[model samples]
Target chain A: MPTQPTDQGPLTSQFAGDADMLELLDMFVSELGARSEQMRDLLASRRMDDLRTVAHQLKGAAGGYGYPMLSQAAGVLESQLAAPVRDLGEVAHAVAELQSICDRAIRGHRPAA
Target chain B: MSQGTSTHVRIDAANLESTRPLVLAIDDSPDVVRLLQVRLKSEAVEFASASSGLEGIELARRLRPAVILLDIEMPGTDGFEILRMLKESPDTVQTPVIMLSGLSSAHDKVTAFDLGAADYVTKPFDIAELRVRVRAAIRTFTLFQMLAQRAQIDGLTGLWNRSHFDRRLVEEVSRHARHASPLALAMLDVDRFKHVNDSFGHPAGDAVLAGVGSLLRKIVRDSDVPCRYGGEEFALLMPDTTPEDAAAVCERVRQMLEQVTWPRHPEHNVTISIGIAGAAKATQLAPEAWVERADRNLYAAKSGGRNRVVWTSIESPLQLNRAG
Candidate 1:
């Protein structure tokens, strides 16, 4: 079982001893990866509106799933995409950081016996 | 850490997905296209081929490939003419082109290089050498893009730093002025952030900043711009959002932050005070005026026992007001 931070929301504690935490984390990671790919495609196509939409979804989902780091990175990326023409490097960096966090979380959240 | 042979370049696997080198191959010879395609087939590359210079130009315009392999010996429109056309077209000029030719003469190579060909590869080229050059070109282009991205990003939080915020502000304000769209600015400050640093150290402060950053991202729409204005202070520019709407978003962020559990220091609760200002006809007012109004309201929140959202509007004569 994963140790839940006592100060966090009830959901965090509910998933602590449950066997479902691993599955939830895996689902979150897969979703983030897919969303990241979609954002990258939108950005490369110069479709700022689509990119912003995908990034905004990622930001919201990551936050709701308790992956605050990924959410923060996605938020920054979402804002950049919202601009008339986003600085590509800024978006890339934010995406890179988001990927890192998602990867780390996926690695850390292992199912308990 | 060896001299010129250093393989210090970190290949991020995630970026390699859509960021794979997009190569545009322009040659009249199908054989040459197949040969080059075979040589460049790697995990990090995608190839788009055009049999004529005109076709290449069209593909280049549409696909915006990262690099172009142009055969200088094409019949109707030779590589030089194509190069000229490519350079003339603003859309394709920035796309790097590599000249492919049977002409090994120094003069031909020099002319091709002078005509803005990134490099010249002689016909019957070493397949290995061609692969190396293609990789090098892609690597250089990617590096240039990374440098461009770094310039606009906030080094700390990786947010769209202040300069980008300023540019977006000017543009949004101009659009609002033209369309009379409502625009709101929310200036957020972490309540007692210095104390977080003092008690838990800078790492914990960083954690809080990261937390706040994520929280703000959650409550805003995709069209809104959230920026790290400066140390412990962030700003959000909400285009087409009314003051009431922006306040609702900021208030949600405030509540979210208040709920975040600080790692290793659960007792040290975090809170944010937001100052929101909006203009229905913001184009009439300068960008700084809107920001200043939001900042003043933020100050009001801080003075009035923090952890609340304060808002003001161009329509409201009331200096600035706070709500719990």
Candidate 2:
């Protein structure tokens, strides 16, 4: 399990004080909630293909939404999923790491008001 | 990373229409599109978005925007495929594309570059940096358009220059020959142009040339191509025109020149000798030969009188006059 970063300041600043940034941050949080749930369900069911699809989407989207850590985690998990032989333990670990990053980023960027 | 940030700030989606050159963003993520809209708005760049590669391709074809920001990952027709399509299309080939992807790997970057991306920007792009890149792309595109315009236009008369005229003549001649359609070539020379320069000064001579150039542009049909063939000489390539029709147009030009109110030589008048050749009379000959035929008639016009049109007769090879 990756340690959760205590400070949300860096993530919040990514919005750059723009209303469109806030909207994107809100969208990111909403999408993260849905995708994190889907990821957990897919991981628990051992559906590597579906789980990789979710990871790939996050890999492309997270960084654009100002969540680089989540993008990195998702990218790693996606690559691991692509391996011909995947270790269940490693795949589960990568999924958990991605989930943690998503949680932190969503919490940090979501609108305060 | 969300610390020391102000809350409640807003970034509206940039307006679709503006004086700025358009910057199209093709990304599956709505969030990225919004992000781009906000960041690029500072540069006064207009925004257009597409959610898929196929949609992007269609939008690109229609808009022909100044630049494209393309995402590498999409449901269908992915970024590389879209890039290939854009590069292949004649209309969109000149548009600069900046690849937006989360894949920061050297291989991915190299692949995008190889596929004709103008620049590859990794995800979580810096707004300031993106703005700079977009401006640079616009600058490059503008420079290319200006250079292309310069190449096809005459510097002095704003008419099609000799080279462009030749190219158009070749194209029109080939088409006319292939279709057996009517086409005519007219050659005109200012009478006593050297005397005009010697008497009044080069500026007056230039004014006369410019006046005639503008007049040719104004009087000719839309299908006619008027070009400054060389100093004191002008050529008109008229497609879908008969020998009689071409002579009429040339005669109008000759009369217009005689009536032009010269600023430098108000008391003096300018005159032009014109020669015309119809495609029906010279269909079997090459384009150059056809032009030479017009030149021969031009010589006849000059020799017969300095202010008349001498045209080749289709029925008989004998030269005829428009105003005898």
Question: TM-score (0 to 1) for chain A, all models?
Answer: 0.65, 0.83
**Candidate 2 Cα outliers beyond 4 Å, as residue runs:** A1-13, A41-53, A104-113, B1-19, B166-205, B214-226, B235-256, B272-324
CAPRI docking class of candidate 2: acceptable
> What interface RMSD do all candidates show, one decimal each?
22.3, 7.1
lDDT of each: 0.73, 0.80
The alpha-carbon deviation from the true structure for residue B40 of candidate 1, after best TM-score superposition, in angstroms, is: 5.2
DockQ of every candidate: 0.01, 0.39
Residue B251 in model 1: lDDT: 83
What is the model-wide C-alpha lDDT for candidate 1?
0.73
Best by DockQ: 2
**Across residues B227-287, which tens digit of lDDT does each residue of candidate 1 receive?**
8999999999999998888888888888878888877699878888889888766458888
By summed lDDT, the worst window of 10 consecutive residues in model 2 chain A runs over A7-16
Q: lDDT by residue for model 2 over B1-324, one digit each (tens)?
A: 111111222223265455568888887766667677866756866678877777778887877788999988765567899998899898898889999887788999898889888998877677778888889988998888789779988877878899988888888888887888888899999999999999999999998888988999999988899999999999999988988889989999999889988989999999999988885633666789778989998998889878999998543677677653
> What interface root-mean-square deviation (Å) does model 1 yield?
22.3
